[model samples]
Target: MLDHLRHLLAQDPKLAKVGLTGGLDIWLFRNSLKILEWAGSARDSYNSGNTGLIQRQAVRILDYLDGTQYVQTENIPSDIQPILVDPKIARVALLEVSQSEEPPGYLKHIGNHLREIISSPNVNDSQKKLANEINLAINNVQSWYLGVHDDAAQLIHMSPQQLHQPGTMMTLNHMFKLANNAFVGETDPATNQVKEGVSQIHYEAQRLATFDIMACSNNETSRPCV
Candidate 1:
């Protein structure tokens, strides 16, 4: 599923330049950490056995996360470097996820890191702004999810008479239609906000397209699309 999604994004001219966004990004980061934690536990459980393969895989993932630096100094595209280099943004995202009622250890670790960064005197305004944006984006998506779930629960718990009522059915239909629109990149009438995943992809595509046109007008080469 991950590979397929990556391929789809890569093939699109606009989406090709986009990086991770919303729940998908958090999900991948969380799972990557979980993988390392699980591998360590397995190695500990089987001390006598050869765990070199699992250890090596974990090391590679860690290197990808921490070793490779994406910053202003590197060959990374200027448009995307801010996102790639801003550790505070990633930390804020993880912290947001950690705020769940029952967050896991990995999330807690992320929260701690975010706290440290927030408390540090060296942090800059750009980092703080990036963190704020990430948090707001996450909160928007969470609100949409909660609203949709509540509407779904109403359908699940409705009595037979309530289900049969014309008004009840209409309300349910309206709620579902709103959800469908949000799912496919439309603005939610109730909240007046676009769904995060859909909006992120759409915005990136539009931004990239505009950049390409501007580049062409200037007679400069645009970034290659997959």
Candidate 2:
């Protein structure tokens, strides 16, 4: 899915200038690239029968999640907050985890067993203690996720109309500019192509303006306004 979206974004330079599609492309590229990398690494490991690398990939994702679970939204821009807590994004995150080739209610079943371990009379104090700790850890992960799906899933999946909100547009435009500056000298083929496309757009606009001025000078109509 990420690959397909990226392909579409790359296929059209004009989309990069439009806030709706461009903002999504920028957000996904900036944030979700690592997730895609981890999934790819896992696939390669599974293919080569190197289980160690696949285990490492899981560890990397958990570590990253642990680090970002307590993200400070206080410093985030007000306009960007709405996008963070959007319910649609949260649903997408849950859907991705739930449909991971596991049986229905897999995670829910795990949670239920944890509860039974903590409450059953046969369980010893140490066993219950471990269950309590695990339960707390899971709760911490859930709280950390909330409406902030990006912290975990790292994808911003929403409708174009949703992204076209005034505040959202403003925030995305700001993010796009920061990203544009950060990749100013990146040597990747795709990055270079994007830069070239932007340059071409600017050049064409200037050339058209110059032509308009020359035409105005040769015409008897109103003069070119500066």
Q: Model-by-model lDDT, in order?
A: 0.35, 0.33
- Model 1 clash pairs are none
Alpha-carbon deviation at 215 in model 1, angstroms: 27
lDDT of 1 by residue, 99-202 (tens): 34222222233233334444555545554444334334444434543454344334334444554555544544444443333334456699997654324433
Which portions of model 2 show Cα errors greater than 4 Å?
Answer: 1-107, 147-226
Candidate number with greatest lDDT: 1
Give candidate 1 misplaced runs (Cα > 4 Å). Answer: 1-124, 177-226
Q: How many Å off is the CA of 138 in candidate 2?
A: 0.7
Instruction: Please provide TM-scores, in order, for all candidate models, with all chains considered together.
Output: 0.32, 0.26
Q: Per-residue lDDT tens digits of candidate 2, residues 67-157?
A: 2222232233232232233222222121123234222121232344557545665555655555555444334324322322332222123
Weakest 10 consecutive residues of candidate 2 by summed lDDT: 204-213
Predicted structure 1: clash tally: 0
